[model samples]
Target: MPKIGLIGFGKAGKAVANVILQHPDFTLDFVVRKGLKQEYYSVRDFIGVETDDPALIYSIEHIDIETFLDDHPVDFIIDFSSQESIFYYGESAARRHIKLISAISHYDEKTIEFLKHLSQKTVMFWSPNITLGVNFLILAGRILKKIAPWADVEIVEEHFKLKKGVSGTALKIAEILHLEDEQINSIRVGGIVGRHEVIFGFPYQTVRLIHESVSREAFGNGVLFVASHLTDKETGYYSFEDLLGPYFQEKENDGLC
Candidate 1:
């Protein structure tokens, strides 16, 4: 069985855990956290085990440059931790030559530098949203952008009020579209899981492509796919785009069949 470590116990983390449990080839090794045992003991019941010592951690919380390097002979690290945690873990993972998969979208020059340097040391996958469908939109948007180069583009994303940060996925799509930062908008209202729309307009025509995540389950599936794929890879950066090639190729093959 391939052993994997999870960094967060949030909505997406919990959802991915359920999917991992059903898989025969993957086994969750540990869930890392720093709070009182009581706070995450419930998590132990859900995934299994609790520990503060980095060496003892099946999953570690509060990952950083020094801590990750000190302990763990992990094959791959899945970080849903935090923006800060992502950068720290990412850098450490590269230095140690450990493969990393994360859902973090924000990246600074240093972060990008870390990824580029790590390109040879470890394989890294970073995506704001990992759901398979969202990546389809990304690919589709690329083709659409060339065809409608003159179209004005704007993005709107909605998340639950308690959600953190602006829409990482929204900003990513904007990055893909090469839109200026001012063209994107993020909204947090009641308990929405995730929803995003990319609207393109010119003169009298408007084209709107939207993705609505009905539940956290969509994210769970995406993460499960990542874990399943990454657990056995050698090393290099990846994204959902890499995983979806088979699906897209199958569609092309179907036409011939």
Candidate 2:
């Protein structure tokens, strides 16, 4: 059983908690947020832990995260907070050698460098999208890149208006396809869950790869699966593909398609 601490109590957080409670091997220690003061929030109705307490948020102190980690600690930390918060939280995790998992839309050069630095001392599993199906595409893209180096590609991503824009996850796929940031297109509309399309343009015809997330539960399930394998892992940063290696290996054993 793993003692998990979750950060953020937004829509995604609530959905994740429902799954966490059902998993017999895991426990939801606490949830941390900016301390919203309302008569009631819909998310609070569903999740048991809803508070402004920073002490129980995976031992991360509100004022100074790094200092708090020395005193309080847990098995693993899941960050669903803002981008800035993740940078601070990740730095703290690195210092205290805590196993960190982030299933958010934050992925920048600085975060990558921080994770790489922490990998030498602690484990950090970070991904823009943790959904298993999407990870399979990421793996496939890597293989395809090797097979066809000059596959002209374009990416189109969509998310809810509440979400900023084309997520870092979609941009990551573009990176895999060797498409620059400028080539990536974003569409933001009302209350969309998540969607990404990777199209390869060719002289004769075109090939397309698409991953659509209809519900937040799908993402939550993937997070739980990753968390299950993350505990006691080697000190380093990992990706969804790394966690799903065995499944891919089985596919290879059966014979490459």
Candidate 3:
């Protein structure tokens, strides 16, 4: 079983913790957050679930990352925190051959280079959008574009009002389909989790590919999905498309209908 370490305890992290514990194929090691009154939190008690596993939570401010990692080594580190969180676990994790899965929405070019650099020493994957539905939408959009290269395309993304500007996923879809800036649209309103759609306009009709994240569990599910596939992979940089592409190989060979 793969031992997992989580770097964020936010809503998505909580949901993922539940998912990881519930999975029989993996084990939850520990969670690292900035500050906490307690030295450690019982995963089962904190999450209100019954489990024999002794997963715990530790505050980043209180623990020495290197020492903690050495004593309780983890197979993979799931990062849902800020892009800068990489600095906290990057070199240490790479030295231990720990895999990295970063789902942070955005990162500067320098941080991105560091992520890629760490891949040389460990299996690393960086996907701003790790939800399976969204990546499926991206893959489906790419295949459809091949069939309808002349189809005029428009991309629209909607998120909660406080979600700031266009999501990295939106820009990713736009980049995948080779759409212009003006062709991409963004709407922020209400508390909608997230929704992204690509419309292909044909002379007679239009086709749309859409994916909406209704809950944070999708993040955990996607992580599990990717982690299972990477178990035997060699140290290198990877993407969701890389792991998911093989599943569509048969379809691609069949002409992607």
Candidate 4:
């Protein structure tokens, strides 16, 4: 089992943590959260699950980054903690030659550049929206556009009421599909985790590609996919698309089977 460390303990983080805990392929070593009050509680106890796993919870408020990484080594570190956490642990992770998988959701170009530079030291993938179904939707949407270049398309995203503004995923899709901001629609209702749809309006037919994230566990599936594919990969700064794109290959033939 690959030893892993998690960088956040919020709603999304906990959901991913639960996925990791329930699985048998990965051994979750530690989770680091800012302002966390507990230091030695296993996720099993913390989440009240019946398991003997040794996943501990750590707080940045109490532990030094370098010493913590040294004391508790891991094969890979998954960051769902914060947008700025990479700056704190990037060098340490690189020095230890640990793979990095981040789902920070948002980052400035400077932070992205930092990840690129650190990639020289070890394997790293910075997935902004690390959901398997959503990424597949992105790839499928591209194929649909290529197949029907004349079709008109619009992007629509919906989230919970507390989420403000258009989602990053919607913006990314719009950019990939070459659509304007006005062509993208945003809707916020009660506690919808996330939903993104691409509606292709052809002259005679309509095509819709949708990915709905009912729970954050969808992210764990993404993590499992990335980890399985990336374990033996050479060091580089890869986007989520980089991992999934190659698998979307086309088989050439003149006739259908």
Candidate 5:
């Protein structure tokens, strides 16, 4: 079983932990978060685990992530944490020769450059959205862009009210379509998991591509899929799209209608 360290304790992190515990191929070694109050429930409860083995349910405060890693090395580090967390521990993970998979978004140019630099030392895969369907939408957007270069393109994204900022998937689609000048409509409404739509408008026709994330578990499954595939990959920078080649090829071979 591959040992894994999970960073962050948000919805995505909890979902990933839930999935990891059920899978026999992976072991959840440690969870890193900001702080743990004494009155709070144990790490097992935080991660929604029923049974408790102290070793299996260990939680490391963010400040001690490096120390925990030094004593209990992990083969893969999955980060659903903030950009600051990525920047802080990325180089450390690289130096330790640990593979890091990040699903964080809203990166400035400087942070991206830094991540690219870290990739040279250790295996790193970064994606704004880890969901496979979102990546397929990206691929579809790229295809549509080629077929309709003259069409005006726009993206609109919707998420739960608690979600802050625009959808990184929408931003990424805009980038892929070279529609940098295009505006993205980001809606924060009630109970929405996620939804993104890309529209191509020409003089007389319109093309639309859409993806809806029904639940956070989709992202957890996607992360698990990515982690499983990284066991044999060489050290390098990888995008979510880079990991979709096989899936796309298989679809093509099946003769998509």
Candidate 6:
């Protein structure tokens, strides 16, 4: 079983942790949360244990990643933390030779460049959204763009009110279709998990490709899938698309259209 360290305790992180706990091939080794102590009795309790079994004690520790690398041996680290957290821990993780899978989104250009630099030293995977459906949409958008090079393309993404700016998934699809930032629209509303639509306008017809995330578990499941494949990968930068590309190719061979 691969030992894992998780960063952040937000909705996505918590959801991924739950799925990890249920799986047999992975072990939840450590967690990095803001202001966590050095040691803990139970991982569940530290992260708000919700199980019915009161006596289930799994000795997992929590620490800020600054101190985490000094004394721990973790096979992989999955970060759903803030961009600031990634900036803080990126070098340390590289120094410790830890593979990282980051799901944080909307980083500035400088941070993105820094992560790319860090990737040269450590195995790193970063994606705005990890859901397989969204990546498939990206693939679809690319194919559509190739088929209709003259079509005007635009992206509209909707998220919960707390989300800021356009989604990374939207930006990625735009990049695929060579669409500018002005061509993308962002809507923030109530409690939406996530939704992205790519519209292509031709002379007299329009086509739309959409992907909607119904639950955070979709992301968790995607993370689990990516983690399993990324563990022994060579030191380099990667995205969810890189991990799933072969599967998509297989589907294409089997008639994806």
Question: Cα lDDT of all candidates, in order?
Answer: 0.70, 0.71, 0.89, 0.87, 0.79, 0.77
Tens digit per residue, CA lDDT, model 3, 83-148: 789998899999999999999988889998999999999999989898988999999999999998
lDDT of 2: 0.71
**Candidate 5: tens digits of C-alpha lDDT, residues 16-80:** 77877767677777777765642234556655675432323344443555676798788899888
Rank order (by TM-score, best first): 3, 4, 5, 6, 2, 1
Per-residue lDDT tens digits for candidate 4, residues 1-257, read 89889998888988888888888888788999887566677887878766556889988888888899889889989999877899989999998999999988777889989999999999989876899999989989988898888899999899999997678888888888888999999999999999999999988889999999999998987887888888999998888778877676553653321
How far is 15's C-alpha from truth in model 6 (Å)?
1.4
The 10 consecutive residues of candidate 3 with the worst lDDT sum are 248-257
Model 4 stretches astray by more than 4 angstroms: 251-257
Q: Which predicted model would earn the best lDDT?
A: 3
What is the number of residue pairs that collide in model 6? 0
Candidate 4: residue 238 Cα off by (Å): 1.5
Tens-digit lDDT track for model 1 on 184-234? 888889998899889989899888888898887687677767777776677
Candidate 3 off by > 4 Å: 37-39, 251-257
Error of 1 at 119 (Å): 3.0
Model 1 vs. true fold: TM: 0.78
Winner on lDDT (3 vs 5): 3
Q: Name the regions of candidate 2 deviating beyond 4 angstroms.
A: 36-45, 48-73, 91-96, 249-257
Candidate 1: 10-residue stretch with minimal lDDT: 51-60
Off by over 4 Å in 1: 37-44, 47-74, 87-97, 202-205, 231-234, 245-257
lDDT of 2 by residue, 40-94 (tens): 3333344564433222333233445655455556667777776666666666767
Q: Report the candidate with higher lDDT, 5 versus 6.
A: 5
**Model 6: ten consecutive residues of lowest lDDT:** 52-61
